[model samples]
Target: MFSRAERKGLRLAGGLTLGFVLCFAGVAAAVLLGHAESGDGGPLLDPYLVRVARFTLWQAALSTLLSVALAIPVARALARQRRFFGRVWLLRLAVVPLGLPALVAALGIVEIWGRQGIVNDLLHLAGLDNPVSVYGLAGILIAHVFFNLPLAARLMLAALDRIAPEHWLTAANLGMRGPALFRLVEWPAIRRVAPGIAGLVFMLCATSFTIVLTLGGGPAATTIEVAIYQALRFDFDPPRAVLLAALQILMTAALLGLIALIGRPDEEGATAGRPIRRFDGRHRRLSDGAILFLFAAFTGAPLIATLTAGLSADLGRLALDPLLHRALATSLAIAFASASLCLLLALPVVMTPRLADRGGTDATTRFLARALPATGSLILLVPPIIIATGWFLILRHFGDTTRHAPAIVAIINALMALPFVVRVLEPAFRTHLARTGRLALSLGVTGANRLLRIDLPALRKPLAMAFAFAMALSLGDLGAIAIFGADGFVTLPWLLFSRMASYRTADAAGIALLLGFLCLLLTLPSASAEPETKGRGNA
Candidate 1:
């Protein structure tokens, strides 16, 4: 029997389509406002914009090179190592940065690597000055590598896990060791996924704003996003801001284009990769053991420090402040709301193009539609400060900033996190639909029932995971909140910043730890929900 929801597919579809329309409307309105403010001509390019663009790309390239080059040993070690002391703990620890806020991570880095930090303290004890400059390209690189290497290692480890046991066995039988085995097995697999991992990580570093701002400390160290913020906040240069926005679009698009060339396909016919024998050589054993410790320390120490700082923070005093409490409340609300909003906005974009035709999705069109999220991801290209500045100007011109208020911040955060929502959900969505598509059709399954009965159960895991990731992304965001969050619309990170500036280090660290835990809590259900792929068995 057809469920009530199945009968109502048309209505649900319409509502979903409407939501997408509204979401896209906000994007359109923002651009139009920006364009009108710039005058009759298009966004004009200037010398400053050129300089910012060059620095942004240069730093991103350098960071990418360092991150990937460094990740090689870490990834290989994780892949080769199967059992060791706290190895699993190390692997999990490395993923912390992915969910941690950029600002929070920056705080930890400053505490650890700053002039009065451990490194400098040791240097001072040695009879040398604090020669380490933690505020330029070097500082930026340190933070990027810190965050990106663990991630690259994970991706590489996953890639490395796919080697066939037969290949290893045959190599052992043929007395193939060292270089020959690597070329036959390791090389092929790493070659396949390396570009994708590098592209993703590189693009991530390329567009990063918060790390650049906190660690940059100077004009030349600034990225396009940071520069856009400067053009708006410091110089009030609208034209330059717009120019940087356009530049971000161009560069990020080029990066994503490269990603397309290397990423694995996700079509219906795609199967789980064939499995390979897990490595068991003595050399491999030692490599895995060292990898465990290296990645663990690289990823874990900062977190341990942050958590320690947080737990020891004077939260008893901090919470006594009304503003801190208010900011905490606001951050929590926006994080959840933004995540939900992104999911709603993506449904139509994902489902509509397929439902309208019903002849199974056209691969090219589907991929193109998938690109919508990435394209909209350009919001991240322009810093929240820049985006807020533009909107602030546009709103002020209309004689009202109060009217937009928290809604503006919420929308921007939602859109900024939209790409991740779409990307994470696309595969599971397709899988669920493909598995049940024809079955649901003949049964006349339609609306919420169809979604719940056929779609939800099948997609329950991925859907839940997508939501968690979106929430985590939103929670870590610093963009829109930096500007729009003023006047009582503050977020946790904003509050932490205010406290740290006032020398309330204990409070800031406490809030940072709290924020970290909250993100972890949000991430759990989504992750545990997804089933393992074929080649993912313990190596």
Candidate 2:
């Protein structure tokens, strides 16, 4: 597909992707080997492990069910009410939670539903003696719903958007009413996408560490991922940690296999005709209005409470605190470093020659092109905590793990962000290359010159968007940081979590606000620059 220099670049890219995958696998293997050598020959299937596994399964299943069920009406209502006031903005707001830090959103959820929160306050005003507690299982479900519901809705909305206008027009012309229209047109679209969305949500909720740690309240609410963290950090039990990590990988692999069987919904592209006016939902205005209002309130209430709670906080003192300043700097540095690494690792894998490109018809080229991106995204199947645990165990054998924590955290964060970076950049890069490859080649533009002149200008926006996304993801991450954070390596999320754990509610709330603001600031550029991609599965 290219001159010798370009082929070399592609080879280097492939090598990088393989090296990353091997590093991850190597760490996990070392952990397992260490566990085997430890001779802690006790049964792995202890009662506690069993209980944690069961709880993890049920919570994830319940969260997925609730998120998907609720998303249906909200997505349908949004699709039907196409031109309502603030509709576009509402859709945009729905996606904000996707990028919102789990810890930030958890704080927001507590502010809304915690015993002393807004809901309880309203109940008290109404003379109701019983106050609600956003803790334990209820709290976990509420937080999961708050995050995943919007994600599910966005995906379903995108599915509805893909329904050709002619289908709607035909439904109207045939006088197909609510259930009939839904049955014939809407249901099929949703069904095609719902399985993938559900599977993704389930995987996310299953691997949840931050929300489970913060809102879990006690051991009864503990998940496998959190249990692994406890085993490694609190108990210093490498054997137990490795076992839990293995269990998580097994469960995730099984779920992925099941989801793969469902297959992905076909990507919807632009139609070459005028938009057809939707008429099936015209008479269901009142019901749709109520659904819209309920979802909007459900999604917005936590954010509102976060803002309100932080208003009374001593911002100046918090801002001036040296520890807070250090954490902020650490977070920014980590975010920048990880995002840069993610781009460096992702670009080559994405830029590799495809099966159909010139001089790329060989099966060897095709296999590598496909396999390389999969390798880049391989971290998605393995939780960040698992990687961190493996490296932590390996490093502890030789030296103080704290000294090496930041580097491990940075590498894991980069890998975690790699999947998203690849997803965002691969399509855009491929499209650009396909459109301009011949022109660039004819102009004798190859290798460094070609990338500098042709690819750079065309891909600048997407690259920026990918970087912003990668940065935001790393900034908000709690998983790798939870494992690697030490006295000198505290990031904002780690600091915020510490304050919350220590019962410094005011300080925690303040930190939460700051962290949320920073993440949102990073995410805005990506959100604004890129056309919204549908169904960012499990990213």
Candidate 3:
């Protein structure tokens, strides 16, 4: 339905986005391959690199196991106890970690598990002298579980929720309880989503930078991302950084390929809009309650600790700190720019398919349409640091890359948020077009006229929500910033990490609180809109 200029503009936008990604990939490959160090007739796997890779895989595997293993029972308990007081809020609480900045969550984990933390105080009160050391693999796993368990639980619960109410009713009629009920009814649903969830959790843990960076303590606990960061910034080893980046990309690609091969969850029967009162687990009320209580405490304590610790800091001093002010301003500017860029690029990438449909038999449009979304999401596989490092290598030849930090950081952050933007907008665009395309076409409305009056109105909410989500993701991101951040170009996360690095615990706490609040503020608009979206769906 678009005019020539509108269609051209869409093509131009998609072309530029695709071009940028191709350029990044091309330059990165050239630089990294140019520097690939194969040691004298041997493979490039140095002992140190091997150790780091092994540790990375080991930690990720353990984190995935613990998070998914714990999530199963917690999800089951929450699924069964659907009518308890505050159950709705508790369900909501399970997802709170998804919004939490990694740095903020790490701080909270430290507060609850550090030697000087609440746990140690309780231990001391009990006449125990041994203190918990949350500074190694134990700390990394704890932080990952703290972040991923709720996510796993929420995903598993969604699968459980999809179980047709009739199945539950059938189980109740059959007098099925616990193991028998789970084996026959619930396991299928959980099993359907489990592999996908595990893969997702594994990918997250594997690529995790902020959590591992903070809790890794020293060399023994470093992951590939951390090692890459160290290689570039600390050791100034570009070759090693390139090698690590290549390894990370290959590992992620392999995992993604594996997950794809595993296939999607089989579709289940649809549920009516009726409440599901599960009766099979009635005898486990006390047990379920205990499980939920323990899980909640496990997940919720760090959040409470973060808030309390932040509150205990000198707010007035934090307000007056020049560094904090600069970081906040820098963060907001970068976040807004990143979010805007993400939406701008995402719009065309998502629209390409629809526009291509008009081309009918044209293979080029079809190819462009299919390839753009995957290309946009390709940023996820290649971590921002790798992109930043590649750009760093290219730009350092011209002049100071530090001068280009803001733009570089914003662009990478935008790209990092691209998948999410596409995820949010593609469906809305598709739905809107499916419902309105013919009417608009018949009314002789097309191009800018159709866009401003028709598409914009229908898409405003999703666009705004996408912007907010992208802004939140960029606001909390430390990956790009970690690579490009300089003294003059620090964002909130960068500044927070800097403080924590210099043993400024009090300053770090205050910054974490501020950063968390800003992220939460950006996220709330979308979070609050969920019910409204669901209401529309139900209607």
Question: How much lDDT does candidate 1 score?
Answer: 0.68
- Global lDDT of each model? 0.68, 0.84, 0.85
Candidate 2 Cα errors over 4 Å, as ranges: 126-128, 266-272, 353-367, 528-539
TM-score of 3: 0.94
105: Cα error in model 1, Å? 1.0
TM-score of each: 0.85, 0.95, 0.94
Please give, for residues 1-539, the per-residue lDDT of candidate 2 as tens digits: 36667776686677666777677767666776678578568896889999999999999999999999999999999888887787877777787787789999999898889988889999999999988878899999999999999889888887887777778887888999978889998998899888899988998898899999999999999999999899878998888888888888898888878887888677654555657478966788889999999999999988887877777789999988999999999889989999998899887777764533655355656777767877786776788888888888788787777787877787889888888888888888878877998788788888788888888999998899889888888999999989878787899999999999988989988998988888888776456321133434345
- Residues 1-539 of candidate 3 have per-residue lDDT tens digits of 55566667777777887888778667866776676653133458979989999999999999999999999999899888777887767776776787789999999999999998989899999999998899999999999999899888877887887788888888888889878888999999999889988998998899999998999999999999999899888888888888899899999898889878878788888667566678856677899999999988998899898899899999899999898899999999999999998888898789877777756736666777888978988887888888888877777788878787788888888989888888888889998989998898878898888989999999999999889889999999999888777886788999989989998988899999998888887776465321220112210
Candidates 1 and 2: which is better by lDDT? 2
lDDT of 2 at 295: 92
Q: RMSD of model 3, in Å?
A: 2.8
Best first by lDDT, ranked: 3, 2, 1
In model 1, the Cα lDDT at residue 273 comes to 52
